[model samples]
Target chain A: MTASVLSRPRPAVATPTAAKPRRRLGPGRAIPFGAAIGPVGLLTLWAVGSAAGWLDPRTLSAPWTVVTTAGDLIANGRLQDNLAVSAQRAGLGLAFGTVIGTVLALASGLSRWGEAILDGPIQIKRAIPAVALIPLLILWLGIGEEMKVLTITLGVLVPVYIHTHNGLRTIDSRYVELGESLRLPPGTFLRRIVLPGALPGFLLGMRFAVVGAWLSLVVVEQINSTSGIGYMMDLARQYGQTDVIIVGLVLYGLLGLISDGAVRLVQRKALSWRRTLAD
Target chain B: MATHAGGLTATRTVRVRSLSRGFGDRTVLNGLDLEIGEGEFVALLGRSGSGKSTLLRALAGLDRDVAGSGQIEVPQNSSVVFQDARLLPWQRILDNVTLGLRGPEAPQRGRAALAEVGLAGRERAWPNELSGGEQQRVALARALVSEPELLLADEPFGALDALTRLRMHHLLRELCTRHRPAVLLVTHDVDEAVTLADRVLLIDEGRIRVDLTIDLPAPRSHRQPQFLAYRESLLQSLGVYQTEG
Candidate 1:
């Protein structure tokens, strides 16, 4: 038994193999082209349809008409002014909602009494979509900047609370034990262990919050007397200016993509220590 | 209680009197009393539900949630190394070692401990970058960096492959010899107990059933007659007697 077990073949170390050189237009390089194909294809089809006079120009303007209208809006400074207003609303709402949601999540997540007291109301609030609160908000705050900003804030709150709370609750018990064994103070434990452990969830929540912020802005700005992309779209809808409406939509898409990209960059930097299977 | 054994008069690093712990209606540790002398290496052998881990957790003050009545005297400064390395996934290797530690010399001591565990130049690497054995080595470095008086290990090498387990056993023995910290190693492996511990304990039904001293020389060999004798005795205590036709 001794000889056989002792002389058993050891597990071999994984040798570092020379990486095969990637081929041109490989799968890695093909992703961007694949992603762009659908949008580009749709645009080309629109252009062709318009050129062939197969589609009604009044319903959907040609792509070039939308581009020139966008240029006109930009030259007249309406696009910039409206875009600044929308940016301010989204930024303010996102900041306030993120702060409130994170604070609530931390309070409830860390203490049992906090969880018992706060979780029920928050869960109920999550169930009632933020859009449902628009009528009440309009009544209380009027259809002004406060109402618009508050609508976005309401939209941003739920995702941040849910994800961040889940992250805090699911921290590994082993780490908590380590904290106890080391006799770490409460502040140090929260700062060093709890916060960092909960970051992934917080970041995930931020992604959802970003989308929510934009959606709420779209809904709120459409209500009354607003200077934003949504307001421009509403005005264009009245005049049947589909080209201007499309420009507003394109700007919205661009902003969404840019904001999501920024969040992804932050995620990458913050979670640098993680080694996933893809790595 | 102090015991004079084998000419050494080491103070007790751990003392438990009438320690009783239960989960719901089931008792895991029943009125157990034990003592571990300073710098002594004690290996505890037990079955799956024999409360070996419970005892270790209790000594490490990690069993406060358990329902128990006992007087447990553990040193204020003691460290625990679990089967999993439990390094924070977000921190660098050196930072993980120095976790929960403060003072100007912490980084220096952390680096020194990493060097002692054969992980000298890998300080900036993340925990996920290391292999299973290497991570366990980092765990050891983390535990020893603080210079704890008692080190509680719950099957620290149980997850490793056989070859790595052997190497870990050698490394643990060396570390114990050098640091001279009282160690309580809970494991199911009989050979591991025979090879590494100064004293081997068999726990059965939440009580110590066999307490035997391994008086073998340093660098103990499995082929030795005395080593086999100890192994056979331990196996018998665990109710796995060898059969001869």
Candidate 2:
């Protein structure tokens, strides 16, 4: 969790000119602008080619078609309901994964005995493909919401656990010396030194967990679901409703974008110390 | 153990008898004996691989493997300042200054410490935001914040440029005079040792090779011929010849 790379100081801001207006663009500016470039260019090319009949419309629907269909889905209240279901599953799974992963990682990092007990088991489990566990999870939990949540939890836990453990283990030895020299109590050391030291890594793990939760939710929902975005995609695929599939894909991408944005915001707030170092 | 049990105005604030230390098979300090009196500033000079650092570490109680059952009974704990500032990178300047304090009451104490170190306006600045000299000051503030009865500095200003080092030496002398802690500074600079220390202890081949007292006034300048004479002698003891000007 001590991946210090992400918080690297941004390059110095460009100097202002009298003819040019300026606005503050800190870290998040790069993300949205960078993300917009590819999709916006692709959409522009598609719209121009399709309108000029250089591209086939019968098979490949236009951007307007995707947008209109999204409207239709929303009008029926189906999109909101499905989004609500997917969010519920992902939220619960993330809560479970982060809590358990952090606790286990701390134990492994702090104690040799805990590492001995956990290392092999965690290694073996990490290699087990999350998708392959779907059948086992279904058989054990009967394809209920619990199974979906558990699947997402499994998908999210390893990265969080490994990152957290590494972060905790890799703290500078000098901090430990400082603790000893100061004669800090065990609880105070853990709280004041260990936890803050591990925070950068922990936040990175949460970012990974958010993305993992989304990926796991889609896969889990595809297997068996009464209501969710993935379920809608599955139903549309059976009926050759490729347009619906496109809509669902767009929604999923947007959900990922939004969640990642949220996580980055939290990262900035937690690491506001970075602002002081920026030139 | 370099602590001594002598009363006020004791012959030595610290005394080490048959002290030895090693890491596994590599012995750093070999049966070294030393003594330092109250109100005395002793500079320990050595080559890179010599045991000067080990000796300082032992005096600070940072080394558990020091040989011999010697006694160290200082009035209180010794404050240590290391080579690299070693300030917690995540902490603000003020917070770093108060790094030794135990509780929530440390903020006010931290600010006061920063003010004492001439860094009053930088309380909220992060460690990386400070210049090299400023960072060293933060480290000094942290060491001095607790009002330690003894100060152990292991090349604390080794990373600084010459001018900055001079300023720091004066600041250190002023602070030591004000606080009057028995100071043991380890340095490779011959002039620095002769200028700042009331006494200089030269460690070579894991033993004290020379112990010479420097009789100079407070805030002694390098321009004084007497100071230069002592510097030349100490440099000669280290096998360096003073160039005739």
Candidate 3:
């Protein structure tokens, strides 16, 4: 009976050949193609509308006209000058805001007294959007480079504080117990465990900060800036130079995408230890 | 009645005098007193919520927040292995073994301990990459690498499968014999207590109810009549009697 049971063949089931093989695109290979489809389709529609004379060139410039205008601005050094000014403002503001936010998060997350003092004020500031401070900032700092950088800094601070503080507070207590049992020194505990555990949240906040920097720059630069992409767009609006305006908007979108991509790359490298279904 | 083994010998590794602990009017460990000798293997058995874990935590000096005070003594160099392994996911296997250790030879010593636990050549693997049994082995290596004077294990093998638990039991026995640390294993399994412990204590209602010594020979077998008898008596003390004829 044992030999017969062992020798018995299994019943027919769904075989591998039953399912047809389909071509599926991996994410890495699909990205460029996926990214092209949206802008390319929109540009094609714009070009067709301009060619058929259904859209007036004064209201919405043709795709080719915007490209030629971008070329002209680059040759005259107008685009480069404004882009350089904006980049410096955004970079300096990001550095200052990130440092202050991280220090505040660590202080509050690690100590009761720090939280008791800092939490109430930070929450009050968070409730009031940074844009609401622009008029007050103009009254004080007077719409120079200082005012623009300060606006971006305020915009960057809120997300960094919220995400990083949440990360530090929510570290697994089991690991904390391990550290306690081993009697890890405070400095070593913070360096090895707490900081690395909070890095993902910090990077996520940075992505938000990058976008916020641009949003704040758009408003602050338009207010009274002598230079920047927003100033160029405002100049174009005065003379109805729609093509230059389109170029400025496109540059802003590209810069936002590039900065966010840099943060994501750093996040992937730092958190390579994590495993999830998406991987 | 309480039994006292009087004498302040240098070999006495643990000494607890009237230790009492409670949580918000709910008493967990009520005036419990116990002592353990050097290089001794003691198993604590209790039903769920009977204060076995609380007593073990007290002995490990990890119950600082609990109410009530008592004189509890333990060696300065001690380690604890929790039920969940608790290896840091961010660290490699070798780093986890040498966690909190500072010396020029610490990494080499960690490698040696991993080899002793049959986890050689897997130093660079992440904690999440290992199986449950392998993770527990890493925890054991981490605990033993420091050459602790007292090793407090809180249901360390409670999450393992039967076969893995059997293997771990043998491995733990071998390691304990070689290292000779005073071990206090808190477990709920009667057979596990009978198989591994030199002395078994049953805690009930926040106190030690039964304290019995197993005088069986080394390399004990469950097939032996003495082993079964100890298992039966200890099970009965825990209010579990076998209904088998």
Total clashing pairs for each candidate: 0, 3, 0
| Residues B160-198 of candidate 1: C-alpha lDDT, one tens digit per residue | 999999999999998899999999999999999999999
Give a tens-digit lDDT track for model 1, residues A65-172: 999999999999999999999999999999999999999999999999999999999999888877788889889998888988888887898899999999999999
lDDT of each: 0.91, 0.83, 0.89
lDDT of 2 by residue, B33-77 (tens): 887777679999987888899888788777764553445555456
Each candidate's iRMS in angstroms?
0.8, 1.8, 1.0
Top candidate (lDDT): 1
lDDT of 2 at B75: 47
The superposed Cα distance between candidate 3 and the true structure at residue A107, in angstroms, equals: 0.7
Best of the two (1, 2) by TM-score: 1
Model 2, stretches more than 4 Å misplaced? A1-34, A48-60, A275-279, B1-13, B64-76, B241-245
Please provide TM-scores, in order, for all candidate models, with all chains considered together: 0.91, 0.86, 0.91
Query: B230, model 1: CA deviation in Å?
Result: 1.5
Q: Output the TM-score of candidate 2.
A: 0.86
Per-prediction DockQ, in order?
Answer: 0.60, 0.27, 0.51
Candidate 3 lDDT at A99 equals 88
Instruction: List the candidates ranked by DockQ, beginning with the highest.
Output: 1, 3, 2
Model 2: colliding residue pairs: A1-A163, A1-A201, B3-B72
